[model samples]
Target: MSFEIIGKTEQIELMASGKAIHDLSRLEKQYGQGKWRKLKGVALVRLRNGKIRKAELHWYEAHGIGKKEIKRKRYLD
Candidate 1:
């Protein structure tokens, strides 16, 4: 299923301008599928300042959580 942000561009811009960061967890919950893989693990990104970052997939869980609760993995490349 395709994921959609439920807010307008102005709302997004407002959030971006604030100290509070966007929630990736919410985005993934609404749009993610396909074995719940990490996007950063499979894709490459370059910052505007010319810094490149790489990531690796990892399995993690919080206390009192089950394996199925494992969230997206991330690592620096």
Candidate 2:
């Protein structure tokens, strides 16, 4: 039961919702309150036509979610 999400705008929107969903009461009892980070990265992409392009990567990281950290990355390039 797993799937992948693609797109920068969609990923950022999801981050907003995830941030709002997390609070003191919902924080994992075993861990401290968590924080989030968005890292901008780059990658190489090959198109259908066999051309290589530089891609912009949008990666979001969050911790303390039920004892596990979640990371989501999006491509915008």
Candidate 3:
């Protein structure tokens, strides 16, 4: 499964310009595959300026053939 944002990136006013994708294999190793369904966790990010921010995590669900955004959650600050 993958994710896509909802707008034209060039048009966004102030989107995060830098990104760091973490290797979540440790997560799967710690907590098996059973918890991923219907549970969109929060993203804990540390910006270059040294401030921590949280972002909502959205996931797509398989329907017929295509997928849809079926879950979302707000991150805690």
Candidate 4:
């Protein structure tokens, strides 16, 4: 789903890190080599439909590569 984050993510938590990430190789191949992490957070997002809602987001991140493949995992409200 396509959406824009309306504000900062809150309740940030790590779901996985380093070798725990199954897509480690793909992440590095696409973004660059670094310590990769999978995380989940809550934030308000403006979806493609132009409606705003709270959602649980999942994404991958690396030191210098930053957040990648942000996805809306579920609607929180």
Cα lDDT for residue 51, candidate 1: 51
Q: Which predicted model would earn the best TM-score?
A: 4
TM-scores for all candidates: the values are 0.22, 0.31, 0.24, 0.95
CA lDDT of each candidate? 0.30, 0.41, 0.36, 0.93
Q: Which runs in model 2 stand beyond 4 Å of their true positions? A: 1-33, 48-50, 63-77
Each prediction's RMSD to truth: 15.3, 8.6, 13.4, 0.9
Encode model 4's per-residue lDDT on 1-77: one tens digit a residue.
Answer: 58999999999999999999999988888888999999999999998889999999999988888998999999988
Per-residue lDDT tens digits of candidate 1, residues 1-77? 11211222121111121123244365346544222321112323344566544433222222243223222234346
Models ranked on TM-score: 4, 2, 3, 1
TM-score of the candidate numbered 1? 0.22
How many clashing pairs in candidate 2?
A: 0
Candidate 4 collision pairs: none
lDDT of 3 by residue, 1-77 (tens): 13333432221122111122132344345543322222244555444566555656544322232223333344356
lDDT of 2 by residue, 1-77 (tens): 02222332221233333455454334435445556443444455555566555554444445643323333233344
TM-score: model 3 vs. ground truth: 0.24
Off by over 4 Å in 1: 1-40, 56-75
Q: lDDT rank, highest first?
A: 4, 2, 3, 1
Q: Which ten residues in a row have the lowest lDDT in candidate 4?
A: 23-32
